[model samples]
Target: MAPPLDTRSPSGPAVSTLGRSVRQAGIEDIPAVARITQEGPLRTDLDPESAARSTRLLLTHIAFERGALWVEDGVDGRIARAVAVVPGGQHSPWETVGRVVAPDLARVPPGPDADQAFRTELAAVAPRWVLSEISQGSRARPGPPTLLEAALSWARAEPGWRHGPIAVVADTDAERKAAESLGFAERWTGGPPSPWWLGVDTDPVAPGQA
Candidate 1:
């Protein structure tokens, strides 16, 4: 069975577009939160149990005060999208972004490893934030970009996160394109450890330029 959900309140006014609204997630939002993350189709070759476990393990420790999660609710009251943007201090989570996303992390059962990976990277990155997970739930494939923009804009507004750079690890072409288009520069890519595409957005910039 999967872990249970929590109860949280909205952090601020909705960043709404049409009937869609994006807002910071809190502890109470856990059910919808899990639905958003747990239901995403896994690109890796992993069983459903493992995928569910992986999601549960990561979500066990949420930093609500940090604006760690964002949810976009549709007009019909269904959650349309979600993103996990955690706090990163001196180290970049993108360094191990590849291995981290693997569905296998749940096999550890105890789930400490996955938790440690997040905490460890959270402490080591230079930026104040890490764009960890982005999920568009049982909705359309192409989601409204403003939802993401709102989440990002919220993160950028944080005082500490602005002091350094904001980092993300884009695992797919779609993710990579989105990050790049939004001004995240590709820092590097490597697979000897794990296939990872690391990026950093110190400040927003035009797509074509550095």
Candidate 2:
């Protein structure tokens, strides 16, 4: 069996300039994480009990792997958002979950120093792929695109890993187009249509004949 995950606070310089600190979340954060998700674009219909249970399960799993569950807080110290990074195994799929920025926090472009901090911080976790479900509407909200760019930049920096074919599963043409502009490509055309998977490969030149 694999070793237990590390749920300790991430050690390094902070990565966000919006006066928000990203840190490992504990059991106490379960409710806040669930509450944030309830307000997301992909809101779940699950009841409060179910949602809390699911959140706890995800947080526990991430804690076991030395991976991280990050909570971004506002200046007043209210939890504004959360992100969980799940380590990928050789045969496992990539999965990440989190909330969009909470309403009260300021959104700032990650500076060069901040980007470096992010790269170093993420490398410590070294996930095979990073995935998040960004709401289409969030693109216009303020700082998400910059964060996405920083993520893509990190993926590009690692040559050994195929960063993508990143896919954005969306339900509309406009959302699909927005993903395209950010470098994702269409990999297929069928779905229930409520959530279409729009994807692009990180190494467009990766070997193989498709």
Candidate 3:
């Protein structure tokens, strides 16, 4: 079994103004989180089963750390409408960006090997904050702004991370545009070992305002 969950509630005021239920993802939410990402704009480029397994491992890694995986409830309250992964730690986001984009990581079987791969890469990744992923479901309700609002709120409240750089990776032209509309600017283009575009925004909205 995974370690005990941090009972310290996720920092930041609730974002209910969006008329969506957004909260930190728990162990039980793992499956839905996996399914949403597989069906969303950011593809793992894997088959259904593989993608689910891989995403589970990744989510498990985040679930254990100070980082957070926030999910918005669908119209049917029980299902996840969208997910946003906000990374937090001392390591720089640039250090582990390559490993995060590796296609082979998605193929690792759901076992000790997969756990090790995820743990290793995740340990090296600590950013002031990274909107690591923003995936939507078919019936997605809340948009990126709501998700980002929660992230920015948490960052402002977290020690040693107030108002620092926020990074986001874009996997398509549409995603790139969305990031731009949200105030992110292109920071890097893809190269070997990294297949996605990187965008950075130094100024994001504060808590309760977005």
Candidate 4:
């Protein structure tokens, strides 16, 4: 059976204007979410079916806690982008439990052990914040307003949920601007001018809040 739905009030910090909605993703939403992440303008190549299956499995494991897939809809209610927020636990990285998304291999640091390297690099960049990297994918569509609104909405729903500070690896000035508008600061430049770490401090206002 699928996990129960979360109907509690929004947690964490709150923001305005962006229409945020929560839904328990059924088997049907998998393909759509996948398409948005892979084929959408963001050009994320992750397979929709695989992602959907992964989400379902993850949900099964964390069935007791508050969890949901967040969707940002366009004017017509079509899903512009979506992200899965899971509880922090053994399977879910302690640093990424309440995150809108997690870092993928694309954001892995360059070294023999990429995962360790990535974490080490992330620590150096923002020692105070736990980092979660966002990359371009089919489901990463929507403008900056949509992304920020969605993120803040999720945060507000789980005020006490802990997660790594969000980060984005943008390749262009336009991407940097968009990330900055969402409260990410430039932390460090990466190799070949591709991966630039945008520091996403969880506590943009109060220090030590994140």
Candidate 1's clash total is 12
The lDDT for every candidate, in the order shown, is 0.54, 0.42, 0.51, 0.42
Candidate 4 per-residue lDDT over residues 97-148, each given as its tens digit: 2223432332332444443444555554433223222334333443554454
Candidate with best TM-score: 1
Candidate 3: clashing pairs of residues: none
Task: Provide the RMSD of all predictions against the true structure, rounded to 1 decimal.
Answer: 7.7, 12.1, 7.6, 7.1
TM-score each candidate: 0.62, 0.48, 0.59, 0.50
Worst 10 residues of 3 by lDDT: 95-104
Question: Candidate 1 — what's its lDDT?
Answer: 0.54
lDDT of 1 at 82: 62
On TM-score, the stronger of 3 and 4 is: 3
**What does candidate 1's lDDT look like per residue over 1-210, in tens digits?**
112333444455777788888887656665566555445444455666665555544554533443466777879977765666665542344333322332222222213454454444444446665664445322334344665566567677665544667777544455556677677777754333233456678465323333
For residues 26-48, could you state the per-residue lDDT of candidate 2 as single tens digits? 55665666565445433344455
Q: Which lDDT tens digits does candidate 3 get at residues 1-210?
A: 123566544432445634567666566766776665555344356567765686567656643254566666655675454334445353544323322322223332234543444344444333466665444412233245555445545555555554456666554455566567677777665543433556777565565555
Model 2's lDDT to the true fold?
A: 0.42
Tell how far residue 81 is off in model 3, in angstroms: 4.4
Query: Sorted on TM-score, highest at the top, how do the candidates line up?
Result: 1, 3, 4, 2
Q: Of 3 and 4, which scores higher on lDDT?
A: 3
Q: State which candidate has the highest lDDT.
A: 1
